[model samples]
Target chain A: MRTRHPFTLLTLAAALPTLAWLLPAPAGALGTAAVAFGLAAAAGVRRVLVPAVVTAAPFWLFLFVLHDLPTTLAIGLRITTMVAGFVWLAAVLAPDRLVEAMVARGWSVTVAYVFAATLSAVPLFRARARRIVEAQRCRGLSPRGSVAKRLRALRALALPLLLSALHEVDERALALETRGLRSGARRTPLAPPPDPALERAARWALLLVCIAALVGRLV
Target chain B: MNPLTLEGVEFHYPATEAPALRDVSLAVAAGEIVALVGKVGAGASTLLLVAADLAPRITGGRLTGTVRRRARSGIVLPTPWTQLSGMAFTVWDEVAFGPANLGWPGREIARHVERALERLEIAALAERDPATLSGGEVQRVILAGILAMDPDVVLLDEPTAELDPAGARALWRLVRVLAGEGKAIVVATSDLDAVPAVADRVAWLEQGAVRAMGAPDLLAEEATCEAGLGTTVAGVWRAAGLAAPYPLTVADAIQRWR
Candidate 1:
């Protein structure tokens, strides 16, 4: 499962959610959710399954609080399928592999770079945000107070990260330039993840399953 | 063409009144390693950025100078973590990032990446995740990333700030090896003791300008000592009132004592 091509894994993950939303609620949602969980299991259940369930649990709680049980169950299950599927995908699909597959398949290098860079920026920003929080805490910035105080603390925690991240744009641009990422410059993929025939077939099969489900529901 | 040349160069960061660099003029030849030393906010890092052609071009600053650079340049900035291409999973891929972006052939990229990893003594870490590396390891990885590009000139801003003593020594050796390979290298650092053994020339920066530039022994001069740019050995010698021309390094100090 870990060796499956990133695109193939992505396609399966997306198709599951699409089918869950398009098909009838209750029964259809339950089946799609099962498939999503199965995929999560394949992506290392210890890492993926727990996260998917925990992340989707809040949505279910909110839905139930805002509406009746029947409506909540239907909408909550659909959202769970979508959320779990993406969590599984994120667990298995390495951004670098996806970028390599894109570049190898004749996609624009800049497009691949943008895709990978934006995806990776989340973790970088998260790490920096954590550091800023710790630094502020050490400086006697009380995080628990009135609304205004909390807001001020939030500003303190967020302001430096914002300014430094913005300043990092110039540094990133310089780093990119030195790496020869000029306009129209083609990039060479070293150790591009192999896209075997089986993975391609699996990707097509996932798309077909989604299409078939949609057609059956319409008919 | 000379590897690097800067003539009457002055720079001001956008939205700032005072310039970050003033009347800076210097040149670096192939096979030379020049070190920039100064107090905090002395613009040593800024000077290296300008040398790497990253100052006004990427930093958005006003510059007036006749700058000439003959060969390609790469810079490893102060913070290695910020410079990391976070997408890379392994140390090998991190090192290969620069060459891969250059569109070199796969074999060529692999060759350069492998050599760079070996050069930085990170070959054992080739398969390790870069995110898990320690501060010293990250600095070495960043150096490998820049070196893998095979640029003709390399600029490093405090490359060893995060390294341990042993790691610092290894880095200085790598710098000498790079210069020996005929690649012009410019480094801005606060490591005074290592400069004499590694840097061929030292530029003492003060207030965004080159106050003095001369041999590695320039760090032993009285004026440089007054600015707190002197080597530890020189400072100790002068404090003891031992001699007029103080030693630049411990080896020279030992010779003088003998």
Candidate 2:
């Protein structure tokens, strides 16, 4: 499933949330949420499942506080469907495959690059942040001191990482240039994750099913 | 044509009080390995960045001089940890990143990636997660990544900084093999002992300037010793007052003793 087309996975992820919103509450919302969670479990994105449920749990509590029980269940399930669907997508979707899929399908390389780079920058920054914290601790600049001292430690930790990572933007640009990622050039995907014909059919089917259900609910 | 050339090149990083490199002129033809030796702040890295076109082009610095690159180039910066393509999960994929980005066909990408793995003697590591690699393994992986790009000129900044002695020896041999294959190679390194055996020429940089450029035997020069740029054997021989011509390697020192 992880190896499936990125757009196909995206379609399923997006459809689950849309259907939950379009359909009548409680029963319909619960159904979509169930399917999304099931998909998440099946995909083995165990890292995200607990967080997705925990994240939705707060919303349920808030909704119940502001509304009656039935209404709370209705709105809360819709929100849960929206949240869990995306969380699962984030867990399963590798950014590189997304970029490759986008470029392989004739999308602009710059757009794919921006999306992939942004997705990847998070983990890269997080890893660097950890290193900086460790290095600062070794240097005896305690981050556990008073607020002002902690703030200074943060500044010390942040400045080098920000400068280094910012400098990487330029280096990455040059790296991209050398790789023939010149604007508008169609980069051949060394291994564009297999987007089988069935997956394309499934993707379109997902979109149409969402539209049909939306009409069914409205009418 | 020189595979890589820099003539009268000077560079100053933006907002800096002083230039990082000045009056650095050098040429590297295909089949030649040029090494830059100096202390931590000796402008060796700066000169490499200039040669790799990172100083002025990507680094936001002022460069005044001629830089002629006759072919495509790849740079392997010092920190292998920072240079990784964060998206790659496996070592194979990491090495393939450059060729994949270059839009090579899938089969061709695989070919290049595998060959690079073999060359770097990391074929067994192709399946390992890059995040789990040791410092030396990471260094080799980074070199493999750059080499898979098939560049005509390779610029390496402190390429062996994190390697074990054996790994460093392998890397130096790889450099020679690359040069034999007609790729011009420029390396900025602190490993003076390996310079005599690996480098065809050496440029001594000091305080952001190329102070001297000559054959690898320049390591035996009294001037190099005075500047703290002498190879280990040469420095030790000079300290012992062995002879006027200091030996740059252990073998040479033995011959001198005989």
Candidate 3:
């Protein structure tokens, strides 16, 4: 599954949530949620499953607070399916493979680059945030104590992180440009993931299933 | 003919009154390495940016002068992490990123990428995640990435700043190797000691201007030493109140001593 083409993985991730939303709620959503969670589980229970559940759990609480039980159950399972599918995709998909696939498919170099950069930005910023925190601590900026002090510390940390991230955006743009990632430029895929005929058929089937489900729901 | 030439070039970043580079004129021919040495804010990096044709184009700056590049060019920016393509999972792909962007055939890309990896002595690290590498490793990876593009003109800004002494020496050797391949190389660096061995010519930049340009021995002169831009051996000799001509490297000092 992990070795599947990026488009195949993307289709599965997309189709799961689409089916959950279009199909009848409760039973339909529950089935999709189970499948999505199962896929996420394959990546790792501790890393992917635990985080997906932990992330989606808050929406359930919020739904329960705002709406009745049945409504909450209906929306909650659909949201869970979406979140789990996304979690699974993020874990199983290699960004470079996706980029290569896109470039091989004749997509604009700029579009492919933007997608890859957006995917890579999270961990990049997280690492920078950690460094900023360490630097602040070394400078005797305590991040502990009462609410006010912690908030003040948070402010100090957030400002530099935000500013530096903005500066990095410009630097990254220049770097990408120099690497020849210009708009309309064609790129050769060095290692485009192999997309089999069976996988392509499966993707089409998934798309058709979603369309069929949506039609059934509307009618 | 020189692959890169900048005659009477001046550049200003948007919204800045002080020009980042001022009336800079230089030409770099094939199989030659030119080193730019200066104090901080001395416009060496800006000179490199201009040489790569990235100053006014990508940097949103205004420029005026005759800047001509007869061949393709690539630049290795100062910070390795920031310069990453962010689209590569492995070091191999990271190095191949530039060549692929040039729309080269798969076999060609592989050949260049492999050669770059071998040249940088990172064949063993070809499969590792670039983000996991150390500063020096990433630095090498970045240089390899640019080298794989096989540009005729290579511009490097502080390429060895992150490297340990041994790694820095290896990079200087790589720069010389690149120059030997008929690539016109321009590097902005503070590693004056290495400059003597690697650079064919040295340009001493002072406040966005080329104050002096001459042979690598120019780094041994009193004016360069006075500005604290001289090589370590030269500075030491000057500090010791030695003779007029200061040796630029330890080897040069040893030869003098003998």
Candidate 4:
């Protein structure tokens, strides 16, 4: 009985629909940015918040000009909750643990692996992008250039990042194979997360609550 | 038993007219270290891939001849970032990726992973995020990951390509230690100066074929110079009007200076 970061993911998932229902349309955008920041923070990726906020600024401004304050706030809250939920899960739930959980719950290992790989791809891409940016900087590419020049520098980053990623896909496939990620085999998990009775009860309760809320809203 | 034997192997990549490697034959005895050196794209990487059973198996290409590995092989490719276990948050988990995949017991995985981190001098960074490490640190972490698997035959493609001088020295020291512990190691690298001390033998790959192979002295030969595949030290020594018995490393040069 292995429970994997039950509190974090459960709390986040429970908060999503509530935020969605309570937030107004215009504020929804701001709420989303807040969520993104919150989630990033929860994921121990507080560094991403500055960038995320900057990126979402234009959208926030647009909403502010077009919508009422309550609507904008509601929407903002919704977004923040959703992002926070996902970020929390990403931070506390190891991809391997998630994969094991899915497999233990009768999902195919292939499906579990795909889900796990998708989850891991984000950090991988981010790491690669940083390397490419550093390499470009070493080659005298200005990080603070004109819009077009910056775009060009970004393009340089993109090419190598994508090429390396594609190249690594092959290596990853081989690595996975060597690790016995083959189909039709009942693979033994190295260390399954604890499945505490209290966690199981909480998970089920959360699921039921979410379903009930959805049904009540529809009715 | 020889850990690896590549016999008359040839490989042609898809849509490429020239073969990436041709008629390359080499062997690595158990507990030996063999370093492969030449210019970039001279086929060193391809040779390692072939030895790791990844070239024809994973890369779409036409491969010929026999490539036999006597022991389980693990490869740490050139780009350390690409080799990262994305699912891992902490460096400790990243290094444990390969061993956990092999379904080792938790205790065993922990033991090997701790040993690997210690050997790579990254134990302090164990709880740190792998994605946030510097290039040299990331390279060490990748090496730690592979070494944790306890592969009897390890193949590294430009393992120290991203490392600084100190980091490179540390990796070479670990290479020697692994060999001492009876792991057959094949490393493809451009760091020829470190080869003489780290490698028991050297293989010169030219346009995907074995141009020459023997002791580290082979890299300092007139034949290597004629082939345009002489190492940096050898090239410098040759340009300095040095005669036979040329030095392959700074230590050798210092010794000869006296």
Candidate 5:
């Protein structure tokens, strides 16, 4: 369980450059949309399209006003594709596996910790946000309100969330130090993932194929 | 040998007007349990932090005189949630964090983690997510994490402050077991009743200084009683117009009655 499915993370990393190459031309806008939908479906993140569309609404409107259909579709597809791919990676990649991969691949423990910390940040912030909201609600801050009032409530929620997170930063530092995260110390991997040659070869081949695809598109 | 020694130790926060700990001196030997008893803001926490080498090191504080630990130390803070390894998805990984950091061999780390979980009676929780556990569960998990590290000296600050009576009793029992195994245990807590049973000695901290230090009976003195530091048994003994020397816990009263 500590070892990652190397093919998954490596394939996602490769997708970024492939997107850049295949979506370079205006005529390739349709191709980019197809790729975005296909990738989203493959990653089981078709649910994100609705939210992504909503988030990119302003850009879509701006592109429409400028009469740049190809550019608008290309930008929209790229944004959705990248977000879907990253979100999928985040979902499937256990933080411990990511840490193990990075450390096993010769990255510093500090760097691996940073990567792991960032990955864990989402859930941490979500829990904090939920707590803040609940506390505020208990204190009679209504969730259902006018736009301005809702904004005020959101501001109230944000303050406590940010404040608590900032306060916790100090404790987090002490906790990390107590766990012996100092420099020059070799960290023992409690669960080093077993590396199978077949998986490694597949990952390398995926990388090569992605690069070839990009170079072919460029030339 | 004394596992911890503080000689005329005084500490002041970096920007504070008054010292947090003042002229405190005490010694705790190996295999002994010492409880620091005080009201909130009475410097018990500061003293524990200093003894754990976290005050001046991790916390920005000015120190005077000498504070020494004769062996490796582990400090379990008050809020167990803050001590969690956020990257860990399961309790076993959380407990393994310290040993893994120490670079222990896989087998050693596993042995220690399993022993710690067993000691805390949380072996069933080994595969549970730390973030999903309740406060009491989290506290036990944190204790397990520290115990897995196998530090010679263990310091706990208000370890069971958030726990219910049953949970507190269980935790105190674990503390006694650790002391029995030859680990020096120093704890700061407001639970006076549990102190006499679990601690070999007690230090009363008042306004950042050691106001009294002796056997747990010191907590039964008229002064301590008047100051509301007396245990329930001590209060009962005093109410009965008992002599200055009295029992400090229920078990003591039971034996004294016999």
Candidate 6:
């Protein structure tokens, strides 16, 4: 499943949530949510399923507090589908493969690079944030106590991380420039993941189904 | 013609009162290794950026000088993690990133990437994720990535900052090999012990200006030693109240003692 072309995985992930939103409320959302969860489960329950549910659980509580049960179920399921779909995609898709695919399709090297960088930035920043937190603790900045105290600690931790991240942006730009990643430059895909005809057809079918569902809803 | 030349070049970063580099004139011909040595913030890194034609271009600084680059250039910045393409999953793909960007054919990219991986002695790590590698391993991977691009002029800014002693030695050796292949190289490093053996010439920078330029023996001079930029052997000899003309390396010291 992980070996599938990146575009096919992306299309399915995108289409599931679109269908959920465009179709009916409870039944449609439930079906899409089931498929999304199934995909996430197949990827890994601990890595994808648990996080998706944990992320969506807070939304369910907030919705239930504001609205009735049925409405809460409807919106909660749709949001869960979107979250699960993305989580699963993030797990299953390799950024390098996606980049190769984009370059093979004649996309600009800059566009390919930005796409891949955006996908990978989260973990990179998270690691840096953890280091900053550790450094602050070593410096005797306590992150415990009352909410206000913790907030002050958090502020201290975040300020340096933010400043360093901004500085990193400058450094990354210089690195990229020296590597010949200028705008509009064409690149050869070293190993473009093979996109089969069946995958292409499936992607088109998924797009058509979403269009059909949207038109049916409007009409 | 020299592969890279900076003639009377001065550079100022955006909205800065003082220039980062001041009146730096240097030229690197084919198959030459020029080492830049100085105290921190003395503009060795900035000079490499100018030589690579990056300052005032991607760096958005004001420049007042003639900078010429006759061939392709690649730079391995000081920090390896930040220098990552952020587009590679495996070490192999990471090293291939630059060569692929040059629009070479697939077979050509593979050849260069494989050769680079071997040259850097990182073939065993080709399948590993770059993010999971140690600091020294990542530094090697970054160097392999730049080398795969086959740039005519190579600019390295503290390329061995994260490397262990053995790794640093291998890198200096590789720099000599690259220079032998007719790739003009400029390295800014504080590893003075390696400079006498590796560098063909040395440029001493002080407070954003070229204070002096000469052979590797300059590292044994009184002024360079006084500035704390001299080789370790030279410093030790001077500290021991040895005579004038300090030796640059241990072997030179041994010869002098005999």
Index of the highest-TM-score prediction: 6
**Top-DockQ structure, candidate number:** 6
Q: What level of docking quality does candidate 2 show?
A: acceptable
* Model 6 chain B: worst 10 consecutive residues (lDDT sum): B49-58
- DockQ for every prediction shown: 0.63, 0.41, 0.73, 0.29, 0.58, 0.79
Evaluated on CA atoms against the true complex, candidate 3 attains a DockQ of 0.73
Q: What is the C-alpha lDDT of each candidate?
A: 0.86, 0.83, 0.90, 0.75, 0.79, 0.91
**Cα lDDT of model 1 by residue, B1-258, tens digit:** 688999999999989999899999999999999999999999998888888888888788799988899999999988777677865778998888888878889999889998999988899999998888998899899889988998899999999999999989988988898899999999998999889999989999989998889899999999888777899999988888887798888888889888
TM-score of each: 0.90, 0.88, 0.91, 0.74, 0.87, 0.92
Clashing pairs in 2: none
RMSD after CA superposition, every candidate: 2.8, 3.2, 2.6, 6.2, 3.6, 2.5
Instruction: Give the CAPRI rating of model 6.
Output: medium
Once fitted onto the true fold, the runs of candidate 5 whose alpha carbons sit more than 4 angstroms away are A1-11, A21-66, A137-157, A201-219, B237-246, B251-258
For model 2 chain A, give the 10-residue run with minimal summed lDDT.
A173-182
CAPRI-wise, candidate 1 is medium
Ranking by DockQ: 6, 3, 1, 5, 2, 4
Best by lDDT: 6
Predicted candidate 2 versus true structure: per-residue lDDT over B55-91, tens digit per residue: 7766786989899988888888777776666656689
Collision count of model 5: 0
State residue A117's C-alpha deviation in candidate 3, in Å.
1.7
lDDT tens per residue, model 5, B1-258:
688999999999788989999999998888899999988899998897788787888889799988877899888888877778675768998899888778889899999999999988899998888878998899888888888999999999999977889889989988988888899989998889888788999999999999999998888788898788999888889889877677777887888889
Model 4, stretches more than 4 Å misplaced? A1-4, A7-193, A209-219, B226-228, B231-233, B249-258
